[model samples]
Target: MTDYFWDFDGTLYDTYRGMVKSFVIACTESGFKVESDQVYKSMRRTSLHQTFAIFLKNVDFKKKQRIVTRYETVEKSEQTNDRPFKGAAEVCKWVIEQNGRNFLVTHRNKSALNMLKRDQFTSLFTGCVTSENNFPRKPNPASLNFLCDQYQVDKDNSFMVGDRALDIEAAHKAGIKGILFDPDDIIFVETVPDKRIKSLLKIIV
Candidate 1:
């Protein structure tokens, strides 16, 4: 009965394509000519902020604000991609069938809930920790800690599964093990996660 905390973006949902599109659009609107492939490549290894900082180095603070604002607005739009990754829903159902529990911890706000509802995945989770909850972002452990307390989940018997280093770091900060979902085997780090899985189905109980 391991309790689980899941990252919603690239781990569960295939949101990378949409993210890249939105980012490119935002930067373009802000007068920057951002290449899609370059953005995608940087996003694979870095956070959005770092990616922006690298490409938009010459952009003023006010212009950067406009770009970020535009990105957020576009990300929250209805056409944004919200499809779940292969076997993601099955993994959640597996947790439930094994008498374990699962919850979402994502930077997204209401958009996360909306996507879950749209995809009929809402009932799969015990609860969610989103930006709207006002918790600090990943690697801070505040939101993960809150969820652990709320669900009475034992840190030793819990896992946080996500696609990025921040997710693993956050789980570590919360005193729980982290599972890195690396479908592409892109992460060649010496060590970051307690476990690694190439596919969702590999996450056995």
Candidate 2:
């Protein structure tokens, strides 16, 4: 059975809107007005940290840190409002019904688990690796390798499903397939993934 390694934000869940909103609010509060579309594009192409670095390049480290802290606080406070994408739960359940397993690898801290629990998705995963684990962030493959070793995952049959290029790169680095879930068709990656689909339900084994 194939194992599915899932990304949390923008993959299984439609969290980018909330993330962008929070980021915009934080930046505006810090006296930096950013366009939401630009922020979304940057975030989708790179990461939150990179996005901050890109926008706050001229800001002092102290101000940047404050903005980041504020963003995190806003995001955490609105975590309950975030929801999984349509058919996300169905696709995950479909994998289990096919005797496959689901795993979560996210940059988010323990709050990711809290969201899963809140959404009643905690039991859907066989394993998870989050920021709490302190593993190097994705595209590094450290977290993926840890899960592969820990659960004895079959690299050939398994796939890492994520919305960003880093996820595909990380899966490849870990010796597994990558599935790019690009609903908006805005993401551009130099390397092609094993499969690219717009819907979570298209991830059939």
RMSD of each: 1.9, 0.9
Clashes of each: 0, 0
Task: List model 1 lDDT by residue over 102-141, tens digit each.
Answer: 9999887778888899999999999898888988878899
Provide TM-scores for the models: 0.91, 0.98
Identify the leading candidate in terms of TM-score.
Answer: 2
Which stretches of model 1 miss by more than 4 angstroms?
A: 78-80, 188-191
Where model 2 places Cα greater than 4 Å from the true spot, the runs are none
For 62-170, candidate 2 gives per-residue lDDT tens digits of 9999999999999987787999999889999999998999999999888889889989998999999999999999999999999999999989999999999999999
Q: After superposition on all CA atoms, how large is the RMSD of candidate 1?
A: 1.9
